[model samples]
Target chain A: MTLGEQLTETSDALLELILAAEDIEQKEKLREQFDVITESIEKLVKENVKKNSKEYIAVTHNLNAANQSIKEAIDDLDKIAATIMQVAKVVEMLGKMAAAMP
Target chain B: MIKKITVLTLSLIISGCGLSVTQREAATRFASASTSVGDFSAKEFAAMRDVTIQMNTKDIALGGKAKINDLDGAFDVDDVAIRINAAIALSAYGDLLLALVDDRQSRDLRNATMQFEDSLRGVSGRTLSDADLDNLGALVYNIGGFFLEQQRAKALKQIVLRSKTDVDHLCDLLIQDFNPTGLNLLHAVDNTSKRLKVDADMALAAHKDNPKSKLFAIQAYRLADSQRTRVKKTGAQAIAVLTALKSANAELVNALENNSEFLVDTRLLGVKMKNLGLALKVFSGS
Candidate 1:
């Protein structure tokens, strides 16, 4: 591979190895850079016509999921807590009234 | 009158709804068990001890030269001596024995007493048969250091070994071996996995952008995930049971958020609670 192509592969590989990157937009920028380099090289090699397809699809899916799941988990935790308190309020009123009768 | 009832009802509702797993258990137990250790008193503890002392003294009397059988229940051998001799077991037999040396008591003093009584317990409890006692008697009467040299050291070693055995048995009683509420043990694994995952995340956050540390964090995350996968799913049928418990005792005026966990679970308490009911399964700490 040419020096530019090697540098591109190294960057993409480094990017893939990082887990749960907090900023998906930052990752996408780095990823798009890697893709441009890969697209240029594959055209030169006359490799598969679907050059940047596989990795391009994966990074897109990951970027979307990471952005979505973090917010979802936080919201889900809050919802579970709110439901618990609501249940508690209902039961407490019923039980206390029953407990107090002559 | 209705206003008073409404306030009381509301207060109970808050307590019932907010009580934690441990306190709830204690409340249930308080409703059921006896008020105190009426039968587990010092005298009863002492009598069981007298039987032990009797056997020890009996050995000393029978073995040959001097027949000293004047071993009445003279347990006034000092209170500290009593505590050591009680040798209160943790789980029948455990590997690590916790000695109760009161803060006021000196370390050497407690150790000396523990070693002495532990020897007495071992000799009386095992190995020294009638014939052995007859021989031991001759040695105790005629020889100096007979109690300390052979009997005491042999007994200490034996007691230490027994204490180790006790610790092992107690460790086996760790509640997580089986699910706290069922035949399955997944609850323990779930709690463990969650704690590990949190720790891994914290470690990763601390390490931040370093590649090596991040790799370690990824490995830690995988380990935590593996721990989670080891557990099967939980069944929430017990939630109703807990709900029923909350309803039953959910009355009272004060709402305490801090001690909520202590309020909900069924546990054996070492000492009685400051306030109690008629039924509780108050288990000793040991």
Candidate 2:
């Protein structure tokens, strides 16, 4: 669990213990103080997560590979059929020249 | 010659038939859904920041110890920027997957895989380890390059399988950030709504004697109530979107593994994404 979660759990456990206190006078006073402590703990937990989230997000590398370079490379691949046709034409002309020489 | 033409045509047909129509559709739908989740989260993070500022403003107006100068430091702009970039990166990840199966656009799967390697190299400094790079290289060049060739199904499966761990990690991070239960984005929004309602209640109580002021206060209260409900509903929808995004990737992998038709789930996920988009728009009041 995260530190924030652990703090929250601990705070809840403290609240439970406060609720189960046997001494009535002390229990009431402690509950009031405990409420303030719980509230502070809640805020602390939120801030902790928020601070950690920044670091988490910062390390998230962009996994998107479909950019200008990739698209251009794919576009070049798309011209393969036309390039093959040019190669075929050159080969055909060579065959014709060979026939003429014979 | 004529023989060459016949051989090329036969090969094209066989390659095209490698992935079934249902499989292609499922992959496409999954890509779209994941991309939507990414786009939504990116925008939602900005909205969350705005809501935080508004909450701070309300707290000050309610007689709390804060000033206008404090508003400037109310939010972490750098953190929000990183969140937005991370979300966009996620969308880009989906685009990479779509480019693999999308025959009309990316016919040469080999080049696509290579391009991804080049792109990964560019971003490697930020996060990817050497081991991660080697594994990615192996996945792209060896499994994706050699055995899969240009076969869409096998290539997509390889990409999805290779990306599943990262995808889960990313999704989990986002889920934690947006989870309604914790003191995250949605919780902040909920608190903002409650603060607004408190302001409205104060207005109502203060203006009880003046009829005109009372009318305006009542309107304010109604607006606050409406906003609170909208926030609640949108919070639920946000969770649903994230859940669907994670499940869609997992289900796509499963469908590919079993070679089963999972169109129904994809279609449902698509609709859910659309609904969440609408909900978000309503919540944004844009």
Candidate 3:
């Protein structure tokens, strides 16, 4: 089990023990300790999962590269579309020339 | 001789169009489904932060001791921005994929071809025969569509190959971030909310003698229970969507690698994304 999971299981066990404690002072002491353990788990989890870690930075870089490659592909497709239109324009010119001849 | 050459070229273009029709459909579906996943994640992350802050407020009201540190985690603006930005980048990547394969350009070419055919009728006082006009339309469509499809297939192949590693890593990282068992964001939120629930229960136990105090404690526990449910459900949906995206992307990459026409069955990914959307709408009430 992960540290978070282990800590959580321990915390739950502690809470159950607090419920079972017969002495009021002991119950209060266990509750305070439970609070501390839970907080430590939260802090540890947050520290372990850094949002701006190096891996995330690398992902951002990869996305930039992918975006550039996609942009180039779109540009190339646009040029091909232009060529298709040019072919149509040439065909139209040829038709008009033939019509004007006879 | 020129007529024969023209006929052969048209034949080649039309045949090329047939080759990638299924692949094109697969690329389009992958793009749409993955985009939905990205958009879902970005919204979920922002909502998670808001929910954490709301829970923290309730924590302070319930006399919980760890409010300040938990609230600081929620308010880390730069960290949240990085997470949200990465998700938006993912959405943008999917959009670019769609742009590469969508038929908007070819549709425009069809419109232009019709206009050109209309102009020819007025200028020469000689209307082309219906068959001639039909052939002209078919030729324009096939050539335009073939080139576009061919390029789309090539670009899709290049992109899937080049970006596969990064996409896999990002999706896996997001899944772990939302994982319930790990030392991740979801775990931190779950811990805070669980602590609050415990405090609520203790409050209920402590005020057993006074009716008014008992009523207040009951209401507090209910509030804690409701918010905890929301956080858990939303976190689960985030993980589901990211998991679907990772599998879908890997399937797409594998198809491309094999140089096969059939890419992937996006039905499962589509259903997962739709479910995530429904969960978000219900949880956020918006």
Candidate 4:
């Protein structure tokens, strides 16, 4: 497969994995693994392209687009984390009240 | 009459004219909870605040190398700036709690109670019927207990209000700063990875064509490896921080939910105050 195609496939898979990851640790691991794949793709693109060539500019643009999608996915994950934190705070408060009970 | 006067004078001298040490100690103890409760709340808030500040500082430092000349660096810097702003919000929350604990309201309440106790001593040996003396003692007990309860309720309310505010601020920070920073950091890391991959691939291709390019390819691979390693380290740290924050947030929520127990029953205080009024009425023979 072409580098762009590989990246598109990888990005799709990572997004699905991130969305399905219920555990914070699991999500983080997925993100790290995704980073490795993207890095490899980036290397491939760079190796095959010549400066000012159509292939070079096209791959860069594709990479940028893929990165944007990844950012959106990460943002979704972060939102989930923040929600968890907020819920945790509420639970903590309830616990304190319970402890205070006579 | 002479014998009675002599005994009364001796009793007055022994008890410091009705202001006994025991009475003062009891009164002080009753009011001391005001400060103690405030101190406890402050300590708890500080613990959470410290952890939050540390996380934000780390994020900010991670982005500090971002420069306009370097796309990744510039992006990272902006991400860090968002975290710093969130940290400031967290700091504000901490400050409000500290202020609530250190406020003079508690001290003022204690001093007023002490003065009231001192004044009450003046009525200790007044010429009154047995019924009147009993009423007077009851009045003192009712009023003193009521005062203590009042102070406690006030302290509790302040703590609760401040705590709620802090929680709200935390939520806001998460939305405004934490979420955005996380996205930005991810983007920067992805961008960096892509750049490093390009270099490594280019070097490898060159080496395939010319043996002299082998060293360059090796260096490129090493650099890419280092970049991946850095990402792993940072990812681990971020996870750890978020975990701690999540835990702290949970604790806070539990505390808030159970806050009903901490709430002072002002109605009970009202009853006590009413009893004081009734005791006074009996003493007045009305």
Candidate 5:
């Protein structure tokens, strides 16, 4: 995939992570990590990072390689996602118990 | 040969006079930029404090029900404290610059500048000689064209150097505190999010076993979700503010660095002061 395609895919994944985040704490953590990556991108852009720059080429190449394996990695996350939803359900149930108490 | 020497000396003196004009313009530009940095820093810190207060309030309310600890205390207090300190330093520095340039109408400013200078000397452990002090007083009192050439240059250079040092120190202090405060804010937001998630999960579990309590469980989950979203949005804004502040600090430092126009003009002023010294020596046959 091209660099633009990879970035688009990365952005989608990040959005999913943010939406699925269990609480504001988790969302903040995810955003902070995202900020670090974006800050680096900003610096590179400011420096006029050229297409021929070895680092840029290497990063795009590595990301493309990593993209192939991400589907399997996401499959693993499904199990964790199920567990989190279950926990959320349990917390909702407890809130009912507390409200019903004297 | 005598005529040639006389002409050369006259040209040097004329060039030396021109240096004072150049130095005054450059010093004015530097002071204006430095004031902007101070104003920007103060405004950013105040904004940070406001955001921190909002987050802290949410955290406190959440902590009453959840297992979250308060991580925003330090930031909530230090933000205002640091901003006030920066304002005072900037004001004193501005007063000193004005006292040097403005006429006798700035009498109160002159006294304020003297007090600030004394405080700075106490801190830096540097003593001005009696003659140097007299020259400075003369410069402050004789606002317009009534000063010796070398004394005026010396006083201007001294004031510029002191103002530069003060602004640089303030910037250093701001930069030093910024990173840790940003991190603390992030941590507080993160913890609050986590605690809300756990609370929502517990409420969900209780609702599973108690059908009559379904409404309560739904309300609890909704509240937690909304609070979490609010904290996340605010935390993101705080991060952006900090990023802008860091950039401002870097720009201020760059303007004051040795290669910048401000410092180059200052060096030119030093050269002019030296030329005046040489003229005095030649005329006095010393």
Candidate 6:
């Protein structure tokens, strides 16, 4: 699946989990993370298309190679499709887990 | 038992012998070895020995400017620099013993290591004085002696010695003792995750209906972010702890991102996660 499609699916899975959340406060906080995930994806698909160019892809790839000079470039938020995924994973782990969710 | 007593008694007596017969011998050997370079005399060695002992004993006994001045005298004056360097290490040996002995019982091995390290730095350009560099040799002996006396210091020293080949092995050794002996990484992970659940509950209470509340988001984010940041910092520290002060060989960010201490220090997670809201606060100039 495309990165956007994959992210949307993860978002849906997390939202469905959130809906079952018994704690009203948990529901609200999950709603915020849910909003963050949606907003980040929206930012990617809308305002950041030029950022998805091969130049940005190279930055994330550069991190894997230990190009010491490019550490700052690697930190560029738009360059990190993989990191978005990884952070989504952290959110699922920290904010929502399949095993813990009803 | 008798041998242990003999060894302990001998170590104790040698610790007290002051001026150290062995150090005096080393100074004589150093002087003879370097005579081709200069005629280093026993008097110079004795002068260094006296000054270094007085300086360090005072340093250990009190500490601060008085200590710094004592070393500065040896540092600033000429000709005796080499002898003074060895003497500093020798003098520090007495302090080490005072800390180790039963009544004294202070365990600042790091301080002892640093003093010897300074002496080693000061002596770098010169050969041992005619007295066989007795003071330096005796200092090396005492450092090695602590290997037998203190497990943590010895393990740390060994980690440095062994890190050339197996750095992960060094980290593994740290994991064994960093907590109590039996409670380790696996336990740390399970316990922290469970505790995170409780923190999550608290965050739920604290964050409910408080989207606009600056304090609430900061608290929640800090609670969440601490786990990640602490793990990263300690992983960096473990790598750094092994490295010489000037060197930066440890690319330990990933290890910190991945490790156990991060899990235990979970309070900061909330602080860090608040980064997003804090950034928003800044952008809005609030």
Most accurate candidate by DockQ: 3
Clashes within 3 Å, all models in order: 39, 0, 0, 30, 25, 39
lDDT by residue for model 5 (A1-102), tens: 644234334543554575577666676666565544433333333232221123323333432333233323333333433443344345334434544555
TM-score of each: 0.19, 0.64, 0.86, 0.33, 0.38, 0.20
Residues B211-249, model 5: lDDT tens digits = 645555555455545544544443343333333433333
Error of 3 at B236 (Å): 3.4
lDDT for model 2 comes to 0.57
How many backbone collisions does model 1 have?
39
Q: For residues B1-286, write the lDDT of model 3, one tens digit per residue.
A: 4345447657776665332555566667778876776787677677667767876776676666645665746336666677777778788888999887777777878887887777666565555665575567567766686777678678878887799888878888778677765667667666766766666666666767878866765665666566666656766877877776777777677666664554444547777777777876786652
Compute the lDDT for candidate 5: 0.41
lDDT tens digits by residue: candidate 4, B41-121: 233223223322332232232321113333333223333433333344334333333332232333443344344334333
Instruction: Give the per-residue lDDT of model 6 (tens digit) for B192-250.
Output: 22223333434445457766543543443343234333333332332232221112112
Stretches > 4 Å off in candidate 5 = A1-18, A21-102, B1-19, B62-72, B76-79, B102-152, B162-166, B178-286
Error of 4 at A80 (Å): 43
Off by over 4 Å in 4: A1-102, B1-70, B73-80, B95-183, B204-223, B243-247, B260-286
Ranking by TM-score: 3, 2, 5, 4, 6, 1
Clashing pairs in 3: none
Every candidate's DockQ is 0.01, 0.08, 0.56, 0.02, 0.01, 0.01
Better of 5 and 6 by lDDT: 5
Which ranges in model 6 have alpha carbons more than 4 Å from their true place?
A: A1-102, B1-172, B175-198, B205-207, B210-220, B243-286
Q: Which candidate number maximizes TM-score?
A: 3
Reference contacts preserved by each model: 0.00, 0.10, 0.58, 0.00, 0.00, 0.00
lDDT of 6 by residue, A29-48 (tens): 67566656544553443232
User: What local lDDT score does residue B71 receive in model 1, on the 0 to 100 scale?
Assistant: 35
Give candidate 6's iRMS in Å, 1 decimal.
32.2
lDDT, model 1: 0.32
